[model samples]
Target: MVNSSALSGNDTESRETLYQSKFVYIAGIAEMIVVILLILCFCIFVCFNALILNVYFTTPHVHEHARYVLFVHMLITDILYLIASISLFLVAIYAVYIPMPICYPMLNLAALTFRITACNLAIMALERYVAICYPLQYFQFCNAHRANTSIILMWVVGAVPNVADFFAMQSTVEQDFFSRNVICDLSLLAVNPLQNTIRTLTFISTFTLVALTIVFTYIKVMQVAKKAGSGTSSASKAGRTVMMHALQLLLCMTAFISTVSETYLRDSPVMLLITNFLVFTCLPRFLSPVIYGVRDEVFHKYIRTFCLFNL
Candidate 1:
């Protein structure tokens, strides 16, 4: 009886081990697949943005002083965002393929790129706000030199948090776990309350500023349309375009907000899928093109050309 009982216990242990092995294998494969898909989608977006910019810049009629400058600004920001997405895709791949104790600097590069791109998005929003709300003053407000300075300043400001994150990382001891491949989260760092407070405040400020900009632009646009006498029809068309762009920006903002909110909820399989889908898969790949393509004259022209040629 004792021998039979011992054999049964051994069989249970073996089964548990086999089950865990299978689980890990499945998880790793899924992570790899997702990362590959993300990289491919990001490349596609980069190509589309590049093509649009090229057409806008190369074409004579579209290269007016104001339109040209706006196109250039859009191109710069889109490139930054695309580069940041590539960093994220690479990091996701590393998290799956590599073991713990990753090359710290590379992770820092990814974080820096992402931070800068976030700032760039906010600045881009502000640019659109200026164009829509103060169209008469836009050429004066965002001249070539001023626009360059603003973009440069945004890069510097974005880097400050990344530098703080790097030093914070050195102070904390890194850990290894079996489930996810080589996770490196700054949230796991043992940081001071002040650091946490600053980070939280920064995020709140950014979110608030973007929300205000969008709202103010929309309101100003409506008011301008109401006051215009003979120009009401033209103003209405411009307002519609601005509104469409704002709506797309709002969608991106909402996705990020949803992801943040989901983090507070207890982690479950369903919640994980939903949050990841919004932040990683859906928002980046789909929304950007739909919004930009609709508003972008160059993109529309090229798309029309392509369709005509194909047909």
Candidate 2:
């Protein structure tokens, strides 16, 4: 008769092999789903931004306003942000490990774009304030040239803190059985106390200032709108537009918070963190075009027209 122990051992081995195979299959399916979602997000992002840009450029009335100029700059930043995010997602999927030179630059660009986006929102709030609270001076104060200059200045200012981040980064090579690559983990930037302090201060200060400006300006706008009676129906409309922008700003800030806290979340499951990051990144982009299209009359009119013609 066959030994019972031997048969039992063989059964156990077979069960182990089956379990491993099933795990691998499940993991592969999950990866494929992640990739498909990323592609879908990329397509939607490009399409929405393209729609806004087309409307801004093709319609003379839309382009004449300074606010649309800021919107265009914001859209450019979102495109860059999407590209950076896509690069990171691809690296995570395909690369055994990302090299420091590759990783740091991508992260820094992402950070810079995020900062510029915040600045753009604050500036947009100021523009709205001027338009609503001080209507007579809106044209004189917020002309196209000034709007363009502000956009340039936003990029320049946004780059300063990220430059510090680039210099402060440290990297080392990590090795697996088959391959080795440099890992410039962002948490390393915080290892240096001074660098960490600087980064924290700059981040908090920049965002705080922008947030305060937006809040204060909107409060003033609302006050003016309330006081101006029925003659200021446009002011009420502008308030709704500003409210949409505020919602967009809040969404972006939530993403920023998630990114900043990533180091603290090192113990969390890697896949979970990645999934959360992707949601935060895509949510704002998906909603931005919708918000603008619904809230802004010119954008709404053009989007409807374009949709109908295409249909």
Candidate that scores best on lDDT:
2
lDDT per residue for candidate 1 within 1-311, as digits (tens), equals 99999999999999999999998888777766665665566566676666667776787766554434544564555455445444543444245454334534444454444444444445555565576567799878756566667767876776687677656544554444323344444443434555576566666676666557656665766676777754555556556655655555555455455445546643544334443644653455355664667466667878778668976
All candidates' TM-scores? 0.67, 0.87
Error of 2 at 24 (Å): 2.2
Residue by residue across 1-311, what tens digits does model 2's lDDT show?
47898899999999999999998888778767876777787787788678888888888876778899998888888888878866775565354476656676787887788878888988998899899888899899998889998988988888888776545533322233113244444553354566677677887888898888878887887777788676548777777767777887887777765676665665764555566667777667767767776567787887788889997
Candidate 2 lDDT: 0.75
Instruction: Give stretches of model 1 more than 4 Å off.
Output: 1-33, 60-138, 163-183, 188-190, 229-232, 254-282
For model 2, where is the 10-residue window of minimal lDDT?
171-180
Off by over 4 Å in 2: 93-101, 166-181, 188-191, 260-271
lDDT of 2 at 187: 57
- The TM-score, computed over Cα atoms with residue i paired to residue i, of candidate 2 is 0.87
Instruction: State the weakest 10-residue window (summed lDDT) of model 1.
Output: 173-182
